[model samples]
Target: MNLKYLIFIIILITGITLAEETKQKAVLVTGASSGIGLKVTEYLIKSGFYVYAGARKEEDLKRLDAMKNTTSVRLDVTVQSDIDAAVKFVQSQNRGLFGIVNNAGVGVFGKMSEVPDKDILWIHDVNVMGPHRVNRAFIPLLKESMGRTTIIGSISGYVTSAESGAYSMSKFAVEAYTESLADDLRETGIHVGIVDPGAYKSKIRAKVTMFNLTGSYDLNQELTEEQKKVLNAAKERNNKLKEPDEVAEAVIHLMTSDKPKLRYMVAPTIGAAEVTMKTTLGRVVQLNADQQFEYTRDELVAFLDELLKENSSEL
Candidate 1:
């Protein structure tokens, strides 16, 4: 090869390498105080990405701040001032935001009729409006990056478990909003996607219990000992949930992949169940619908009986 051509090729390669090295790409994760959000922040930091870990609590933020190559910012998704402050902080960093993991959410478990209107509203505000608030605040940064935004949603967004009525409703709304946002942002080179995790162990279960206890709403008058037992059993099952790190791994993959998918369902059982519902049951709705109803009823009844018997023995 000619000397001139060799020098030119070397220059081109150097430019590419420099671009890769200095290219500014940042990931901002909400609810990074704990659970999946904290795990995601850790993974991103390990992978050498500039991460802004946003949380409502100052202590959690301080913990993340102690890590190298990570910035911790106070962000309460439910509060607009906090959201605006976080956005301003990111903008000041000048690294250019690339991804957003909207993991801040709360769940309220109860019968729809039994849950107070205030509790329902609060759940929706956090689960649905919280993401919206964060997105609106940070969308400019996402757009500036041009098509690299990932939103962390939940599997509950698609399927509704009867026991967590208010939670399911909020997640359902989130699913709709995510889909719509994906469509809206498609042409603008700003990708909007959702990660629907099935069951990952987190403080969310304890938070759910706390919400139940602290809620001003009264339990259903018709709720028999049997119904209470079933509810408690369900809560126990949730307590033995999957690890948050697994879901965090999924978030990292979504954020880093060149051709990231629009929707990613994390766990095996929940993913399979969602696919089956959409492909099998979804097609023949009414026919298999009754079978699903019978299955759930039978399981709930069995769970209730076992729980009640256990409680009676304890008494």
Candidate 2:
């Protein structure tokens, strides 16, 4: 073949491949700056996805911009303008969004009495409303591709406890919204899933602690000895952060599978989802029709007792 003709053919093939990539495979990840979201973006790009790595900070998106087959986008899940810009980027590609990882969230740590309502609202704004905003903006594109949406929920949502009220409340709301969103979108051929992580290494725990320390809570307030012990334990547990790869892997699975699971338990430690999956609560979670997922205090305490025994036996 002539050198000129060979070069033309080569260019043509390259264009075709790029076009297919733009047309058939595109995913957007919010809060792609760090932690699980960053890993998910990286994993998807390596797996041949046309990834839109959405980060609020330009500095954080630098690595993603430097990568091939990836577009760095400004997306603050709480900001409508950012969501709009992201939608426009996807539209310009002419490829509908194939998947969305609504991975933006924040943490607030304090006892119920010490955590202010304003703090709780702030956490809810990001953890709960943020996903809703992103989902609302991207529904059209997602529908066009018949794509899937993965909301980053938490094990905290199901197993509420002390010193995590502010964070847990937001996740509880997210859990309900995720379920309702899934039910509403099911008939439209759009799939939604929730990944409730237990524990892993991330900046979130540190953030929670920092917020707690810097917060205006009355340190002069007296506390029972038991309260102080519980408080310290919460801080210590959060400080033990682990790698976020497991959560990223779960997100990838949700994005790639033809029929993704509605709930994925991707945690570094054993959690309510894992324990429940093998016990009676699992049946309740899988089979419940109503919005209310409830357990009496006594029942939950007993369940935890048995769960601990089971875990100890495994060791």
- Each candidate: what lDDT? 0.75, 0.79
| lDDT (tens digit, per residue) of candidate 1 on 9-99 | 9999998976774574788888888778888888888777888888766677789899877889888788899888888888887788888
Could you give the C-alpha RMSD of every candidate to the true structure, in order shown? 12.8, 8.3
Could you tell me every candidate's TM-score relative to the true structure? 0.74, 0.77
Residue 181 lDDT, candidate 2, scale 0-100: 96
Q: Give the TM-score comparing model 1 with the true structure, all chains together.
A: 0.74
Off by over 4 Å in 1: 1-24, 216-239, 268-280, 283-315
Query: Model 2, stretches more than 4 Å misplaced?
Result: 1-11, 215-240, 271-315
Worst 10 residues of 2 by lDDT: 213-222
